[model samples]
Structures are given as structure tokens and as C-alpha cells.
Target: MTLTIFSFISFTGQKSKFSDIIKSKMYFKTKLKKIPLSLVKQENTFFYFTDENPYYFNLLKSSIAKLGILNPIMVQPFEKKYYRVISGFRRLQIAKELGFTFIPARILRENLSPSEILTAVLLSHPHPLSLTEKVRIVRIMKDLGISTSQICTRFGSFLEIQSPHLLEKYIRLSNYTPSVLSYISTHGLSLNQALAFENLSSEEQNLLISLGTCLSLKGYDFCNILKVLKEIETKEEKNVAAILKETEILNVSKDVKLTRSQKIDKIKKILKMKRYP
Candidate 1:
């Protein structure tokens, strides 16, 4: 993708809060000034490609087509005339598609480690991870021999996690089917939402994919969630059958008639309407 430059919204707006989050999470609280998009730069080493990444070419094309770069991309200064994308692969790709020569970016200094840069990028430009992204981050960390504590520390604090146990489930998601994983990515499913599919058989995982959609239980609380789900497995095949009985809502309840297509429809409808009703 090419570089882009669009209007920069303030840090108080919904679009702006993520930039604030990046500042708060990274503990880098400078007066974040809004600048014209022209000063922003793009770097070459910011992304590693795989056909598997949803932020690959197609979605990148679509995001640019629809959002018109709704969110500013992240960047780190490189040399005299370039910036690296810490995140916002879609924005970058779209910029290229839209024929933009420059894009909005947050300029970071040249000397940050990969993890630091990623953490900065996440803090600066978070997309509220799909279960797949969260799992991928966990896997990325473990494979690279990076500790969660370090990621947590650099990202700001491990304490901010509402469900720390999610770290465990995230690492395990790599074991699942690619199709199953794609369902999460396609739907913007979060770690918590993915747990709704957990303790489920492969067949159940498929069912949950159909049931959950891009709406229902956008994500789950992996820590408190899976723990309670494990405890609720009073039947054979806790991996599958257990979810047939009870369901965790906020890691609190295990009883809900969420089966059947109609019920799934209702669940998805209610997901965004209320606060975990």
C-alpha cells in the first residue's frame, strides 16, 4: 500500500481515543498535537506478509473503499524521509488504492525494539483484536521468546487486563482450524468471544462460528471465562458437550437457551444493544 494523509481528529473523539490509549498504555504522555497529514511518513519493514493475515490485500482494498482512512495510521521515523507503520495495514493499503501520496501517521523515534514498536503501535492504533489477532499476538510472543510480562510491561501494565487468564487461551487458539480462526477474523471476534466457542468440539466450534457471527458475543473474557466453562463441564466431552449445557455471560452465568438459529439471531441482535445482557 502507499502513504496517506487525511484529517486528524482530536484525541477526545472516538477516533481520537485510541491515540490517547496508545499514549496512556505506553506511558508516553506528551501533548499529542494534531498535524497536517503531509508530515507523516511510511516505512518498509512495518509488516510481514502471509496469505493468512486478514489485513492482507483484499480487506485492505475494502477498508480504503469504505472508510476513506477513518483512522490515522501509526508510524516511526526512519532516516530523513520515511515512516514505518506500527499498525493500520488496512489504512496503508487503502491509501495506495485511493491514489494518495501521503497519509496520517504518528511519528515515533527510530530506536525502538520490535516488541516495543509493536506495543507502541498497538497502544497508538488498536483495532480491538479479533480472537485471531489476540491469539496471533500471544503466539508471536511465545515463538519469539518474548514474555507476556514484558509485553504487558511495555504496553503499560499487566494490571489493566480485565481477564488476565486470557493470555493462556490466546496461546491455545493456534491449535484450532484455519477456517475456525477465519470465522473469528471475519467477524471481529475477540478473545472473550472465542471462548464462547471453547470447550466445544470441532463440530461445536463450527456451530459457534455459525451461531456467533460478527455480532454475538463480540469477544469473551478468557481468564474468568474459560475457568468457569471448565468448571461447568459436568458431562462427557467437556471439550464439546459441556458447552451444550451452560454458557458463561461475563464469566458469571452458565444458563441460557442459546441454541437454535432463532436463539442465535436473538443473541446476535442483543449483543450490541446492551451491556452484556
Candidate 2:
């Protein structure tokens, strides 16, 4: 087991959004060691993004098989004689699959707070975060008792959100069901588009999702459909589910003969008539 010590430092004469965290008096050292894979727990607390690209996964697997692990995974001591992963989850997973008994790791010697560990993980993350990842981070930090103002100030650059109000909107996404959140992330829906479902019941939300899947609705079309539904519900004094259950909309949704575009267009025309009449 090779051991090496490294110190954490901030660049001099430079300001950072995480200045509060970087300038803190608390400093900890990390050492590189060969830790047994069994002793390392495969858990992630901060990172939420998953690379679903099969080609990328295959490429990574091939690279690891050929070159072995080029970088050390970061882990912290957990339970007794066990280490919990903080970063390099994918590498660790690939290492396990490749039947490696021991893997290189940078082990944190001192026990740090959750926020500190999260900061370290975020700082070391190499790729741009996805929208879902940003939302998950904001939600996690808020749950850790970090004030909204502090989060906005510290993470605004990292999250690519400069406005506190906008950050709050992202935070509110936590109220959505997991399926709804997944739909929002998969469809690349904007904040306003996702939040349009806020007033909907779970059943109504699910219905809309089913409809969207059946019609292959794009983000803009989905939002427009939601707008039409809300207007119709208001004018007709019925909920979205009730409006959707009407024969015309229901038939159009169930019509296998109609192409996705044709179905969406027919539904839009029917909704417009209901909303206007």
C-alpha cells in the first residue's frame, strides 16, 4: 500500500463563488492507498448523474481493461474498517467488474462534515452537470441546512443559475413525484414547463405523462397541451383528468392508426375548441 499526503489549497489573489468554503480555517489531508474492494462501500451521496450511453460505457470498459485505473478513487472512512466512496463511482464499479481485488484510492484521514465532502466531490467532478444533477444538488444542500442565499451565492456558478429566484424554482422541483421529475429531465423541459404540473394531482400528472408518451410530444408541445388543459379545466369547471376522459380526446389518444404528429395535432384542435367554446 503506497501512501502519499496532499494539501488542499486555493489560488492566491483569485476570488471564487465558493470563497466561503475555500477560505475556511478547516483543512484536511488525503493520502493515496491500496484499499481492498470489499472494504470499500459502493454508495454515492452527492453525485446523481448517470451516463446512459452504452458506447461511452463500452469505451470506458475497454480503456480500463487495457490501461487499468489511471486515477485513484476518493473515499472516506465509514463504519469500522470500511471506506465509503465519494467520487469515481463508475471507475470503482468497472474495477469490481474487472475482478480487481484491490484498487488505488485517496483516503480522507479526517472526518469532515457532509457539506465539506460534497464540496470536495463537486470540485473534483470533471464533466458539466446535467439539469437533473443540478436540481439534486440544490435539494441536497438545502436539506443539509444550507440557507438558500448561501446556496445561491456559493453554487450559482457551479449550477449555472445566477438568480436566487430561479434557484428556488429548481428547488421546488423536489415536490414533484419521482416519475414526473424523470419525465422533466428526459424531455429537457424548462423550469416553467416543468412547474406547470405543480397544480396537478398525481393521477392527472400520470395521465399527462401517458398522453405525452403516446403522442411523442416535444417539450414545447407538452407545455402548450398543459396550457390548453388548464384553460379548459377552468372554463368547463372540471379537472384535467375529467377533461381528458372526454370521448374525442380519449379516442384520439387511443387511436393507433393516427401518427404521433397527427394525434397531437388532433388533440390540440379538440382542446382549443373546448378551451374557446
TM-score of each: 0.45, 0.76
Per-residue CA lDDT of candidate 1, range 161-228, in tens? 32446456665675667677776676565655655555567765664554444224345522233334
Worst 10 residues of 1 by lDDT: 1-10
Error of 2 at 237 (Å): 1.6
Clashing pairs in 2: none
Q: Which segments of model 1 are wrong by more than 4 Å? A: 1-70, 77-80, 148-165, 175-179, 187-277
Candidate 2 residue runs with Cα over 4 Å from true position = 1-34, 42-72, 97-104, 247-256
lDDT of 2 at 257: 94
Q: What tens-digit string does per-residue lDDT give for candidate 2 at 111-134?
A: 677776666566556567776667
How many pairs collide in each candidate, listed in order? 13, 0
Candidate 2 local lDDT, residue 213: 71
